[model samples]
Target chain A: MEAQTIVQPEKKKSNQDVIIIKHLNKSFGSNKVLVDFNINLEKDENLVVMGKSGSGKSVLIKCIIGLLEPDSGTIEIFGRNIPDLDRNELDEIRAKVGFLFQGNALYDSMTVRQNLEFPLRRHWMNVNQPEVNKLVQEALDDVGLKHTINMMPAELSGGMRKRIALARTLILKPEIILYDEPTTGLDPGTAKEIIELIVAIQKKYRSSSLIISHDMNCVRLAADRVVMLIDGRCYAEGTYDSLKKSGDPKIKDLIE
Target chain B: MALPVKTTDFLQETGGISVFTGRFFKEAFKPRYEISEFLRQCFVIGYRSLPLIGLTGFIMGLVLTMQLRPSLIEYGVESQLPAMVGIAIVREIGPVITALIFAGKIGSSIGAELGSMKVTEQIDAMEVSGTNPFKYLVVTRVAASTLMLPILVMISDAISLFGSYIGVNINGITSFPLFYTQVFNNLGFSDVLPAFVKSFFFGFAVGIISCYKGFYSNKGTEGVGQSANSSVVISSITIFVIDLIAVQITNVLNLN
Candidate 1:
């Protein structure tokens, strides 16, 4: 008989939705830090979160990164729920995400080169020294700080430190970058430079970015979509122009 | 007024203690080694504490020798005084007293630094960068303490013996060589080893606990003071507790 069994090809799933957070809640004793928080990020999108200082913007990002657990919520990243993952699994997820901390959080003791080299060495052991050097150089170049690669964090200016931190974040070529107050203490000019760098890097790398900032200028310059957090929930989210035109008092206050 | 004040103080103390312990363990194994930061901590913990440890050890030996002189003269066994005091200092007093001083200086500083970092979101920053702040900050610190404290104790013990020699000469005509011989002859491996081993735990406890207090500190400026205070208190108490347990275990083992 010439009859043969039919064969079917398996379809590859799309990772177009990078992050999905739903009904996230967190509390400390009687104080609720995050409540009914929900956010979704598409692949290669730049989302800026803006809020008052204590309005839980940082807390929300921390929860997504698995640094702090939610009281009740689901955080799905790359089609995997974080809370259910074991330590190794969580670590594996974390390796694909980069974070640029507000204070530039560079290791005070290590040279900038070592700081950039550290994560690469840890996660990609098969990477040789020349490859690491080339990658570090590329990252530094992207931040316009290639010359600072050999300097210690203590030796750099605040702006240099921030750039170095950015370089460190870029070293791993992460699929997602989360920035916690990237321009908080910088001078206005330096802040603008950093914001531009953030936008440029995100565009170049095609990585999804979630930037948490109180600075309106940063939100304006870097955000493709702005999510205004207030009272532990997302009060408004749209393009920056739409947020400005919404006439919502809280959004007005944040923009003005 | 006193009731509220007392309650507040108790809460402050308890909160500080809990935060310190929590952070230390949390960050102990995270990666991105801060070698310079670790060295700076060592300098503060090991190098700076040396003067205080040395002075305290010296006084302890001298005072013990002076106090024992009258009793020794009564028994016509004044020559045995050096050995007794030497054993006492190296076996128990040296490590304990040095650790207490270490607790005061190194423990408090670590607690305060880490606490301030926690307050300012530095540790949080470390986490975002894909660096394990625990391994870099806590493990290196604990390791430094474990390694350096024993060396510091050894130096302190030596200085104390010299001080005892000086104290003995103040009353009687005992040469340096004679005093040295007497001290060594009386000290068996049992006396030295147990004391030496105890200090590693002492160092570990001081480092781990102080870091624990500091790393978890919250509540802005208030958390800083809490970190310093709790580090000192817990490390001091733990030194004694560990010492007691070590002694009991050593005695049991030696008995067989």
Candidate 2:
């Protein structure tokens, strides 16, 4: 199971929190997704929110990124409340935050080079062509996909597409990255490669991460801490090993 | 005393579209414009559509002339054929027909593209990466459509007239100069200006409605097709509605 060496020191007293979600609540009609859920993303570590299907993990990330507004509570990123910020204000904060979608939502019609260049050219309008080329090349190199620069997303394999999508996210050199199931829909081997890449990128950039994943292997390999999401609430919070060792029935059910 | 549930749903839908439109305009005029993306969209939306529009326009003029010839000959006013057909094609038929074709082609493309992007989270990716998806996606598309459709209509009108000239020569001897002279003589500033003005509205209508349908498309894989279908239906209806209003305005202004 490769379990023993996966846990990190729970040094809660020192790390600065990069993201704070307090009393978060969201509902669609009668379907309550998140109810008074709370968690903090500490600086320079991966915080994984572990949940099963339909457990509102995606909704929580969307709320953090201001894609979906929560019914109540505050999502503060770097001290600014996301929902309360104006478009310009939110956009400014977003420049420092990158999000990787679960499905690797790369632009289908665009080439890998163009997809990587999208965020760079979009946020900084005055950037010239040479600079854009450098950034694109570097981002592609980071994901070990430099040869795919001209290839369209459709031409890439699932794993290659995921790498390209990550390259696109990395082009901006964001300080924080939110990953929505970065390893979902991958073969175990491919998933392990993705987890390693995630960890490598996080270390290279020194970026804080809030990841939503159901794969315990992924949580073990990438998460510095794990938050268990059960029935729209934060049921438990600790390192992977701590959660696995818990005597509580719900936490035990998930870990076992 | 209260409005029906369907009525309330209709109002909410209208309000959602209005808000979306307003947000589009607000972001459209802001800084950090995506020039390359805009130009690329123009190439895709405008240039790629030219051949189809030209062929359709040619057929429209030829068939219309052929159909009207029998009636004109019955009244012994067959000599007036070029002028009558020119007016019909220039002032209403060409613009509306080209727009309908554009709606079917470009409108559906935009809807399907954006809808898939929405479902897949590319739009959200853009937002999280500090790019305004509304600005980068919606504004560029709407502006390109607004600008390109008029040019397409003008080209289509010219091609349609050429087709009509060929139709005229099929059964009678008429020089190109004489046929074209007759067309231009009947087409005054009143005819050209109103038609030209309305093409912009039609373009804007198609772009906005398609974007609205696509941008908010939901319910997963099925929604992509629904978005494209609904985009065509709504944009088609909107072009006609805009045409109706433009006609009334032209009448009131004594332009026809």
- As for model 2, its CA RMSD to the true structure in angstroms is 3.5
Q: Which interface RMSD values do the candidates have, in the order shown? A: 2.8, 1.3
lDDT of 1 by residue, A1-256 (tens): 1111122112212348799988888988998878787877878888888889988887888888888888998999998988787756777888888888766777665799998987787677689989998999999999998888788888999998999999888999999999999998999999999999998998899899999999989988988777778778877777777777766677789888
For model 1 chain B, the run of ten residues with the poorest summed lDDT: B24-33
* Pairs with backbone N, CA or C atoms under 3 Å apart (clashes), candidate 2: none
- Give lDDT tens digits, candidate 2, residues B1-256: 9899999987887788788889878888878787887998899889999999999999999999999999999999999999999999999999999999999999999999999999998888878767778888999999999999999999999999999999998999899999999999888999999999999989988999899999999998799999999899988988899899998998899988
C-alpha RMSD of each candidate structure in angstroms: 8.3, 3.5
**DockQ scores of the candidates:** 0.34, 0.71
- Top-TM-score structure, candidate number: 2
For model 1 the TM-score comes to 0.81
> Per-residue lDDT for A1 in model 1?
15
Classified by CAPRI criteria, candidate 1 counts as: acceptable
lDDT string for model 1 (B1-256, tens) is 3569879887886676567557666655454456766787677678877888889888988998999999999999988999999988989999999899999988988898888778766676666544567776787788789888999999999999988998999987998899999999989989999999999999998988887788778788898999899899989998999998998999899921
Native contacts matched by each model: 0.30, 0.88
